[model samples]
Target: MSIEIEMETTTMKIYDTEGFPNPARVRIALAEKGATNDVDFVAVDVMGGEHRTDAFKAKNPDAVVPCLELADGSHISQCTAITEYIDGHFEGPSLTGETPKERAQVSMMNLRAENGLLNAVGAYFHHATPGLGPDLETYQCAEWGNKQREVAGQTMSYLNEVLADNAYLAGNKFSMADITAFAGLAFADFAKVEIPQSLSNLNAWRAKVAARPSIAG
Candidate 1:
């Protein structure tokens, strides 16, 4: 479906790190939208605490990657919000659904991917493990992190079941939900949480999504 949306007047700068799932999600959305050339990509040294510094904090209070800096000096943080703006501003494939119902369904599935899988993996990674460093991971909770690993695994199975009928996470077409789910799976891999090989449907779906040029590094 063709969407008629206004272009963003502001110059776009993407602050991100290489190989990070959240940053990769934004890159995938940009690739899908064919808007990669439209913005200046800046690599932030996440491991060097570049994102945690006061200078970076002024740009993004959350101190997280994949933050979009607009020409008006406003910042858009979080993967979903950035993708939504990019989808509406650029002329290309729509990552979020086009219509109201489509948008609602896509947003629903995207949240499911976030809370059920992505956040679970993130909790496990930060709480259960050493994370970035001692200075950063001051409140590590091994027990809570370990529990989230199991939660992530369970969510993966649930996702597998959902994908059994649908071609993508939200519906037949590729959307933000799929990008979020893919990022979640990548996070799981980093967290050492394995998806069961017995879930053939999910395995096939993973392979299919992996083949997409948008996800290709």
Candidate 2:
């Protein structure tokens, strides 16, 4: 199905990092929507502490990646929000969902994966393990981080089971939920977490999603 929206043609700017999962999620969504070419990619130096600078904070108070700056001077932060905007405003296959029910299901699944899995992995990396850089001496959340990693791993196992009977998280059709799942799972690889072979269905689905031109690009 085709969607039509009467919006002016203008380049959207995306602030991203090279290996960051959150930004990659938005990139893949844009690729799925055929909106990549229309976007101006701006690399953010996460290691250089650019995100915490006053300039970056002005764009996103949270100082997170995958921030989308629309031509209308509106800035969008968070992968889910940016993906939904692209899916809603552009004319093409809908990434969020077509019907209200489908939309709700996809949104719910996406949130579950994010909160249960993604956040867990992030906690593991940021608090439990001194990832990217050494933990700041002032950081006092180490204990919680270790606990979060265990929870994240358990959630991943649960998600693998959930994907066993379904071709996609929401249904057979690809949606933003898939994007979030792929991003979260892929990031786990960096932290030396491997998907168990028992989750064959998830592995198969991930392979298919990764094969998309958007993902390859």
Candidate 3:
């Protein structure tokens, strides 16, 4: 069955810039929800400063990608918020979980994947390397950025331990946490932050997640 949400799916539009980690998270979630074909997907040229333009800023004050526009023209930014909305509003394979305890655990694991892996890799790239633009890159600190790379490595070890006994990041079920972790690892690869070969569990988890059609999107 197709995913069902409170809002009209035909009127939903997703503003996204492909290949980016955050936007990929939303795309994967949408795919998993079986809502990809229902929504209008607008691809913004993020590198071309399309996201920084005044018109885009009006849609999302943060001026980032993966902004979800509802039928009323209202927008929702941030991967976690957008994914949470999709998971709750839509009816399909439950990415967040059905039970209260399951939801809490999945949310917690998702946060860990987002902050510990994705954000850390992002910080390292945006700060240590040539960032988006001069206007945004002025505040970057190479030293701090390098430190975040180390932090990302440490987090990988911790996550490996978490996955050692469990099939997925949140537990047995393949949830949003797994998606975030997959996105994070992909981002890390883009940023040249290689996942240590020593992390066997995480490596295995990566292969499993990558095989999913949602992740391939």
Please, what is the whole-model Cα lDDT of each candidate in the order they appear? 0.90, 0.83, 0.90
Q: By TM-score, rank the candidates, best first.
A: 1, 3, 2
lDDT of 1 by residue, 1-217 (tens): 9999998676689999978989988999999988888889999998878998999999999999989999998999999999999999999878899889999989999998898899989999999988877877879889998998888888889889989999998888999999999999989888888889998888899899999988764
Off by more than 4 A, model 1 = 1-10
- Mark the regions of model 3 whose C-alpha exceeds 4 Å error after superposition: 1-9, 133-136
Better of 1 and 3 by TM-score: 1
Leading candidate by TM-score = 1
Name the 10 consecutive residues with the lowest summed lDDT in model 2. Answer: 131-140
Error of 2 at 192 (Å): 1.2
Which residue pairs show collisions in model 1?
none
- Expressed as tens digits, the lDDT of each residue in 67-96 for candidate 3 is 999888899999988999998888898899
Q: Report model 1's TM-score to 2 decimal places.
A: 0.92
TM-score of candidate 2 to 2 decimals? 0.90
Residue-level error in angstroms, candidate 1, position 66: 1.5
**Which segments of candidate 2 are over 4 A away from where they belong?**
1-9, 135-140
Minimum summed lDDT over a 10-residue window in model 1 is located at 129-138
Per-prediction TM-score to the true structure, in the order listed:
0.92, 0.90, 0.92
